[model samples]
Target: MSTTTLPDVRVARDEQIAGALALALAASLAVQNAVVIWVGAPSYADPMTEVLAFHADHRSAVAIAVGLEALNLPLLLGLLVCMVGLVERRGGAGAAWSRLAVAAGAVLSAVFALYAVLWIGVVLAADGLTEPTPLLELVWQMHAGAFALVMPALGTTFVAVALATHAGGLTAPWQRWLGLAGGGLLVVAGTACLPIADGSSLLFVGMPGYAAWLVWLIATGVRLVRSAS
Candidate 1:
């Protein structure tokens, strides 16, 4: 009996940790988006000069967003580790999906890291430049492309984790469906990543998907926390 109870306690603890990490990740991303919106960030269709000016004028805000992203990557990885462990321990059927989630989450983290670094470079380079140089445009484009590519990686993680957890009976049918829909949209948007990087309107397709993901994160986090309680 003691042995059985010990394992239960550990599972509960892991769930709590995962829930907290999920909430934190969502909050961090929300704050970053708020900062970007508050700064009136230029759209992709905007001139490169306007983009350069925005970065130069709002260096501090951009830096803060980058800092939050740095924090978010580790939180994401932690949540993935916890979720994968929980799924594997609870249901063997989900093992394959959990593995896929891990792979995709790893890619997502690496891509996000690159995105943050590129933003940092942009901020640093914008320090005193009055106009956008060819080099600046190149770095900015790379940064944009990196961000666009992140959508597909994120989509894969979302779908895999949702399916894995559902197989483990850790998520409801609604949650599973939501994840699938959102993930699918993101994947579709990723197919046009080059255009998205160029500031095409196709990028809008992923915006709702990303918002759905945030909602899913918060809802799932709540469910996990309540289950632990």
Candidate 2:
């Protein structure tokens, strides 16, 4: 008698499906964040307006920042999902370093991303409880922007590592490009938000890159959905 074990096709299929899901989530979050910028930035587009606004009530100013920063949660989640999907592929592939790299970075960065969101919540709740001051204003905005910086930094690293580990050709080229371009644009766009008072205008600068990545993600999701059948 002879016996053989069947390969774990279920796990393999799930991993592929997850990669596509993560891509779609990231793209949707990016677009949603851009929408908020479009809705809110016009009110404080002028540098002088921003300065004046910040003086009014650190609460309100931080309010705007908080709302915008909210987007980071989903973006980071998507990044983690994408990283996991990519890392999962290496489970028994002998690329221990690559798998570990993405996982460790995902955990480290997700912490900051979550902290960034919670900080805004703290500031928001503190609005009536504490007095608003320039120092506090700077504290929130500076930190908000700071977290934004680190997020994309680590996010991009994850993308690079994932792309390095991913084994596919032009047929699935969008996934790799989305990972690279999405993460890159996020870093650039987040940095650009620092220079301009109106994150909206600056966000448009990233629209092309964002759109490219977004479409890539949606397409990936569609592919996965179809594959499931």
Instruction: Report the number of the highest-lDDT candidate.
Output: 1
lDDT of 1 by residue, 1-229 (tens): 3555878989999999999999999999999999999989987778988988998889889889989988998999999889889998895768899889989999999999998999888777777898888888877877888888999999999999899989988888898898899999998898887897777888888888899889988988999999998
lDDT, candidate 2, 137-166, per-residue tens:
454455445544554555455455446445
At residue 125, candidate 2 shows an lDDT of 39
Candidate 2 shows a clash count of 0
Best of the candidates, TM-score: 1
Model 1: how far residue 224 lies from native, Å: 0.6
**In order, how many clashes per candidate?**
0, 0
- Model 1 global lDDT (CA atoms, 0 to 1): 0.89
* Candidate 1 local Cα displacement, residue 201, angstroms: 1.5
Q: Any residue pairs clashing in model 1, and if so which?
A: none
Reference-based lDDT, residue 51, model 1:
87
Regions more than 4 Å wrong, model 2: 1-8, 16-20, 27-35, 41-108, 111-115, 118-132, 147-151, 154-158, 161-171, 181-212
